[model samples]
Target: MTDASLAARAVALDLVREVLRKSVPLDDAFDAHPDLGALEPRDRGFVRLLVSTVLRRLGQIDALIEGSLAKPGLPKAVVHDVLRLGTAQLVFLGTPAHAAVDTSVELAAARGAAPYKGLINAVLRRLSREGAELAKAQDAGRLNAPDWLWLAWRQAYGTARARGIVEAHLTEAPLDVTVKENPAAWAAPLEATPLPTGTLRRPAGGAITELPGFAEGAWWVQDLAASLPAKLMGDVRGKRVYDLCAAPGGKTAQLCAMGADVVAVDRSARRLERVKENLARLHLTAELLAADVATWDAGAPADAILLDAPCTATGAIRRHPDVQRLKQPDDVAKLARAQGRLLAHAVDLLKPGGTLVYCTCSIQPEEGEAQIDRLITRDDRVERVPVTPDELDGLAELINERGEVRSLPGMLADRGGIDGFFVARLRRLP
Candidate 1:
C-alpha cells in the first residue's frame, strides 16, 4: 500500500480508538483529527467512510470479531480498534481481504503493539472467509445499540417497535430539507419528494451547497422529525418567538421564514455564529443572542418559545451512531435533569396565555414525556394544547396517547425512516 493510504488508515484507527477508549464522539474526533485535513481528498473520504461504518455496524463487527477470536476479550484497545476497523472493511465494507489484513497489521505495528500483528492478520483473514455467514447469524439491531438503551427502547416501545428503531439506525439518514417558500414549487426543481410531515426528501449525496435551490437559499437541511417542532407553532407570523438553545439553527430559520420576530439564543457564542451565517444565506433575519436561556433575562416574556433542549440525542443515532456508542445511562440521567430545568425556565419565559413548544431529538421519555408530565403536574398555570391529526397532516400514528407528537424512527419505514423526536405544545394560563 502507498504511504499516504497507510497513513489514512492510521488516522481512521486513531479515531476509532478515540471513540472506544476515550468516549469522544465519532464526528468530533473525525473533525478534530489533525492529520485528516492533510490527506488526499479520496483518502479523506475513505477515512470518513471507514470510521462511520465501523461505528454504525460496531455491534455486528464486534460480534464477527469475537466469534473469530479464541476467547471474548481483546488484549489492547489499539488491537480492538484495529480489528474492529479491519473486520468492518472485510465483512461490511467489501474491502479486499489482502488490503484490510495488511494494513491492519501495519497499523498495529505502527502503534507500538507489534506483538498482536499476527492476531489481527489471522482474525481479519478468517473474517474474509467466514465473516458473511457469521454476520448473518447475529442480531444486528441489538448488537449495534448499548444494552441499557436497547432495554429502554424496548420498555418504552414494545419489542417490535424497538426492533424497528434499531434496524432503522442500520441505514443512514436521507437528505431532508425545510423549504422557505411554496414547498411544491421547489419540489420538482430539486427532484425531491415531499414528506407526510412537510420536509422534502432526496437521495442523500453530493454537496448540499451545490444543490439547485441552495444558491437562492430556498431551503436548508433539516430532518423530517426535527422540522416538526417548529411547525407546531402554527403560523408564528408577526409573533415574538424564542428559539432557546438554537444553534446550527434549522428551527431558527423556520421561525424567521414563518415571519416571526425571532430571537435565537444559545450558550455558545461561536455556535451562534453558525446560526447568524445560516440566516444570512437564506436572506432571513433573526435576533441572535449568546446567552444561557435558563437564566438569561429576555426582560419580557415571549409570545412563543421553542425549547429544543439538549438531551442524549439517541434519535439521531443513524446520523450520529456515536451517540449510542459513547453515551451511557448516566449521560441520559444527567441530561434529563437539565432538560427538566430548561422546560421549567422556558415556561417562565413565556407570556401568560402564550405558547411554548418543547422538543428533543431523543427517544428517551424522561427527556420528552416525563418532563411535560411533571410540568403539567406542578405548574397548573399551563395546559396542554394537544396537537391534532390535522396539525401534522393526518399522521395520527406520530401522536402519542396524550396528544403530543412522539415520532419514532420506525415511522415511514417504506420511505427512509425519520429521526426519533418528541414534541409537546402547551399554553400558559392567563
Candidate 2:
C-alpha cells in the first residue's frame, strides 16, 4: 500500500473508532484533527467518503466481519473498526479488491494485531469471493440497522416503509440549498432547479463552499423538507416572530428574510454564535438571544412563533449518518418529553389569534404527530389550521390527514429527495 493510502486508511480508522466509541459526530472529529489537515484535498475528500460510507453501512460491515471471526465474544471495538475501513473500500468505493484487502491487513499488523493478520486476510478473501451470498443470506441491507432502531422503525412505519427509509439512507445525500433571493439566477450555475419554497437542488458532489451561490450567500444549505415549517408560517411580512431553539438558525434566517421582526432564541451560546454568523453572511438581521426558551420569557408575545424543538432528528439520517449509530429508541422517549414541555411553553407565549408552527426533524410519531395531538387536546385556545393542498403545491404527498406536513425522502424522489420532517401550524383562538 502507498504511504498516502495508508495514511488515509489510518484516518478512516480513527474517525470510525471515535464515532463508535465516543459518539463524537463525524464532522466534529474531522474538524478537530490537525493531522487530517496535512492530507491533500483529494485525500481529505477520500477520508470523508470512507468514514461516511462506513457509518451508513455499519450494519452490513459488522455482519461481514462477524461472519469471519471464530469466537462470538471477541471484543467488538477491535474488529469493527478494521472491518469498517475494509468494507468501505470493497463495497462502496469499488477500490481494487487486492489493494483494499492488502492495505487493511497492513493496518491490522501495524496496530499490533499481527496474530490476526492471517485471519483478517483469510476472512476478507472469503468475503471477496462470497460476500454477495452472505449479504443475501443475512439480508444485510435491511438488517444492517441496529436491533433497537430496526424494531422501532418496524413499529412506527411497518415493514415495507421502514425498509425503504433505511435503504434510501444508504446512499449519499444530495446538496440542497435554500435561496435567499433570485432562484433563477442561482439555479443557472448550480445546474439545479428551484424546487418548491425556492430551494436549489444540486446533484450530490463537489466542494460545497466553492459552489457558485454559496460564497455570496445567495443560498444557504437547507434540506427541502427542513425549509417547509418556516414557509408554513405564511408570509410573516411585518409580524414579530420568535424562533425558539434557533441555533444554527436556518428557520430564523428564513423568517427574517421574509421581513418578519425576528428574535432568534436558544440556550447554547456557542450555537447562537453560529446563528449570528449566518445572519451576517445573508445580510439579514434578527434579535439573537442565548437563553433557554422554556424559562426565558420573550418580553411579550410575538405575532408568530416557530418552535423547532430538539428531538432525535431521525429524519436527517441520510444527511447525518452518525444519527444511526448514536441515537437509541429510549432517546426518542426522552426527547418526546422534552418536546412536550417546549411545545407547551411555546404555546403559552403565543398571543391570541397568533400563529405558532411546531416542528421536529424526528420521524417518530411521539415527537411529531403525538406531541401535537397532546397539545391541541389540552389547549382549547389552540386549533389545527390544516395546511391546504394549494399551499403545499409541490409537497402534496407529505401532508397528513390532520393538515400537518410530514416530508419523507420517499415522497419527493422525482423532484429530488427531501429530508424527513414533520410540521404543524396552529392558530391561537381570538
Tell me the whole-model lDDT of each prediction, alpha carbons only: 0.90, 0.84
lDDT, model 1, position 345: 91
Quote the lDDT for 221 in model 2. Answer: 85
Off by over 4 Å in 1: none
Q: On a 0 to 1 TM-score scale, where does candidate 2 land against the true structure?
A: 0.95
Per-residue CA lDDT of candidate 2, range 146-265, in tens? 777777778987888777777778777788888887787888898887787678888887888888867787778888888889988988999999999997799988998899999999
TM-score of 1: 0.96
Pull out the clashing pairs in model 1: none
Summed over model 2, clashes come to 0
Cα deviation at 212, candidate 2, in Å, is: 0.6
